[model samples]
Target: MLRTGAQYRDSIRDGRRVWINGERVNDVAAHPAFRPLVDIRARIYDMQHDAATREVMVATDATGREVATGLALPYAKADWYAKRRAVDTMMDAFGGVVSRLGDETIGEMWSLHDGAGVLTSIDTHFAGNIQPHIDRILDQDLFHVSANTDPKGDRSKRPQEQDPDMLLHVVRETDAGIIVRGAKYETAAAYANQAFVKPTIANWGDAKLSEYAVGFISNFSAPNMKFICRAGFAGRGSVEDYPLSNRLDEIDTLVIYDDVLVPWENVLFNRHTAAAAFIRSTLHRYAAFPFLQRILRFADLLIGAALLNVRQTGLDKQPAVQDKLVQLARYREGIDAHLIAAIETAQESPGGLCMPNQSLLYTGRLLGCGEMHNAIHLARELCGGQICVTPSAADFANPETEAWLNKFYSVNENWQAEDRRKLLAYARDLMNSDYGGHRLTFHLFAQSPPYAQAGAVYRNFDWERSAGIVARAAGLSEAVDGRKEAAA
Candidate 1:
């Protein structure tokens, strides 16, 4: 089902208790801290219905009903391409990067669908719950997010040993369902409608069964839920000076679930440690594609900013600057090539759904996310010291400094003082600001940490192929090829 932008706005105004900077937000949709991102999300909903964008953003499902392409199960490489194009369209429309939007989060459920066999082994009812929740996302056009990491008090001791509330566990099972109490660090939960809550990463250590192993769908508007958010970047400063921060800061939140109830149907997996572990292992299998795509756009932003800065200053004529620009281009296209090759060699999942080639997707994630800081620093260097030392918009507007600032800032007829000021301001927001640092950390650890990302690359890489090639070259035994045995 397709929802108009108005319906999307009305849905989040359900009076979900939200707090930012210790102040109660009466309406998240209009609050300064949230309005920018909320408006961006709402515009995406509108894009699904807009005449020019609808074709890319909306697709017909099996029932012949048009639904958001982000929520649709990816059935082929074309579906992956469509999802990528839609995200690019949204980023182009909004002129900034905002990850954790519904498109990126819905793929978490697709990972679960691929692991339904594990759920079936634990409980058939749990297995039955996977697809419908995904369908409900499309049917209601709901905004979805994922809740995985919890503020575990101490890693040294288990929840059973220390405070049990550290990890979200099933408090007790009622006839209706399970009551859960815990907090999750979710980035986009304030304006989102629901989340797929699961155990914190690798929290269930060596336990065959535990309450902390539970995973369920959470309704954001449910009673006893509260969204306590960090100080937002939007209301912190002038939009002219901090354009990206004011418009694209996706405020992270510590969402407290004060003994909320989850209906039986909403309970995805109860007291199943293996199922929980299975999910943690393959959580980003499908989702990482979209996540990597965001990084690619960010790379473009970096390269574009650096390239323009050099051109404005006439430094592009020099070979040293050109070399740095080449490095940035290589980084951007490295990620681009990975995405293309991943789709080109897309693999069919055990669930019969087509997913990007696991190795390329994961290695691409590492390249895109791991080297983002270096890329940003390169952009920072290319943008020059002016990005950090440039006067604010207010200072530039001052009667005392306007003439002097313009005289210095203006490079040529093509590059005026105001345009130069805007570029520096944009570069500062993208590189040197608090929002910039947070985004760096977000790309570093948002999907998982660097070790885990490398671990995924390790797990998915075809070690046997390399080994088989060496064995054949060395005239080793046929026993080295597992494929031959399988063929027989």
Candidate 2:
């Protein structure tokens, strides 16, 4: 059933134990920092019921029950349906709010973990801890955030050798649940959601397992779960200055879990190293493909923004501008091609859920990182100094500056300077903000490290068969006479 925005809001109103700075937030819905994200998510929920978006965002479940794209797509046909669902998610994110709406991404990641859990006993942790949260959230169309990577004090050492608290660990276990202590850094959007899931990345070894292999879901407002939001861009000397400076895309947070109690139901993987590894690997694969698709969609927007800049500045007719635009188009087309290839080569899991071809999917991830970087750089180059010099929205309202801006900033005869400037500013925000940087970081982080990613591609590929065929053809060229050989 499609949930109303009000229903979704009311559902998450249940008291949570979230803390921000030093104060406890009584209601996330009422908090200023969190409200905008909630509003965005509410917009997504409302889209499920919208006649325009319903076809794309809503799908029937395995039981033939209607569910949101979050629930339905992971189990979908691994084809255009799955790809379309991913596109719908990115479109809903608007300004790439997933950094704040990390829960939605993690929720989808957990679905893959859950499917993997069904495959091996090693996946029990995911089945127990992560799957329940996914099921619950999917049923309610609940939004969530996630924190995964730890702050390694030194890159050379493993989790056990590092400060125990550097990585979130189960410090104490009680009848009620486990008391988790430590902090997870780069925890995107933890402050804006009802709850956040923490999944173990990869298990380094047995001894480190207890300290690193814990996975669970916790309410953002859970006791001792403190959030220190990264300072946003454009902070003025005044409170009002901060608002204008803060972009909606800056949703990353540092989540400190100070002896936070996570109940049994929330404990997805507790010291089960094997299960932890499988859950991590499976979720990584499952989420990465969809994430690549979303990045491609975002790239499309960046392309559109760049095109707008070119048209607005009358650079559309310039040979240089046209060349850059064509280059940008090729980049976008390459990404789209990879996405189509991944979808076309998709396969079904043993559990009957369809998934993209991992090889093609990872190729998309590689393309996503490089293409986005190029897109952003080309956009800046195309916009030239206008992107940097555009007056603030507030400046346009000042009568004195308004007249000058109107006279000087106009790009075309028909459009006012302020209007043209506004378009450029929006383009600048899309390509130049910290949020823009975060999007690039996300694409880079989506796949395993470059070497590992290349290795996966090489190892899984069938080069041996092709090599054998080539070797046989080469041997055939070296003729041997059977009777002569016997005489010799």
Candidate 3:
């Protein structure tokens, strides 16, 4: 079921409505805003079929059918390692980072599969769709993304008090399926094939069942879907001046459902408020691994850019510069350690799939995301102010300014003007440009806000065990010790 790059390119040309920068995008695969990522995504598809890279890119499902390595359910640590290799290989081939590609979002569905017991008690019919939908991903090689947050206008009021369409909800029921009317702000909905749509809020306000507490699989080809995307960085600047921005900016979209029909078979949960809470709590159980993994690569970028900048100027010999490089190194290793340890301590989900250790995932995400700005600042400091003041690629090439720029930029025999310009450009795009700011903010809140990320760690951590250990050490009252033991 491995898809070729060409096949992936053709799949998104189904006349879906998509707009960006005040213009309609007739063809997402060919449009400048999406084409770069679309091509990278296509290359990911092609990797699994290429003989040289197939070993790491393809995996055998339970049925022995070959599927994309990233889509397989993790039943063992080795499966996770293979996925790591696949993501690494993809980034290497594309020379950039891409997080939303099916690998990261697939885990949201996996979380639902683990929550099947909760769904079954809520509604048996919708409960049955979990495993089958997961199987479909492996069978069809679907380019799946996640849909969680809605526009959520007027946070002060409930859905009933505000415009209910602000949050996605099931508007009506028909014999064929449930008709949903609302919208979601999805990252790649315009280019992706499908999305697992669900509630964004944690509290249902004691409701047992509500129209908004629904979860279902949405197809981009469904009727009345509209994609309103933010302006992308790809075509906004020259690749020579903004390499990372041009190559790696993933255009995000506000996807409007506009009364689309979701078949009963595609529905994972319906009117189960408990299902909503359960999903909110566990949505990133497996997904966070890939998200956090992407940050690891970003760490490499920060370190590489800063180190190259310092080395070109012979500033690396200084003790101050050396200390700063170590700081970047520590940040990189910290994220890498969490990724490796999460797999080492992986546990089986209730639905019989292996998920990364929860504590490590949340803690690592917080560590990486929480300090993203500081890390950027440290790297930016090491890069010096030259990155910000450097001449544009155009200025460097112009005959009038070429010699003067080269005379000033070129350092020794090894570091030429061109190489120095490229380094500064690379570092600038990450630390001083519009794309740098966008990405820093993106990572800071990628999973959720800081409080939410800390809350996840708070809930998943074994605080009970720690409390019980303290009880034993302090010789607390018998009741307190007994309660702690019972809870543990």
Largest lDDT belongs to which candidate? 1
Better of 2 and 3 by lDDT: 3
Q: List the pairs of residues colliding in candidate 2.
A: 17-221, 17-222, 18-221, 103-144, 103-145, 122-275, 129-268
Error of 1 at 211 (Å): 0.7
12-86 in candidate 3: lDDT tens per residue?
A: 999999999999999999998898889888988888888999999999888899999999989999999998998
Q: After superposition, how far is residue 306 of candidate 1 from its true place, in Å?
A: 0.5
TM-score of 3: 0.97
- The alpha-carbon deviation from the true structure for residue 201 of candidate 1, after best TM-score superposition, in angstroms, is 3.5
Whole-model lDDT per candidate: 0.90, 0.63, 0.89
Against the hidden reference, what TM-scores do the models get?
0.97, 0.83, 0.97
Location of the lowest summed lDDT over 10 successive residues in candidate 3: 479-488
Model 2, position 91, has a per-residue lDDT of 62
The lDDT, on a scale of 0 to 1, for candidate 2 is 0.63
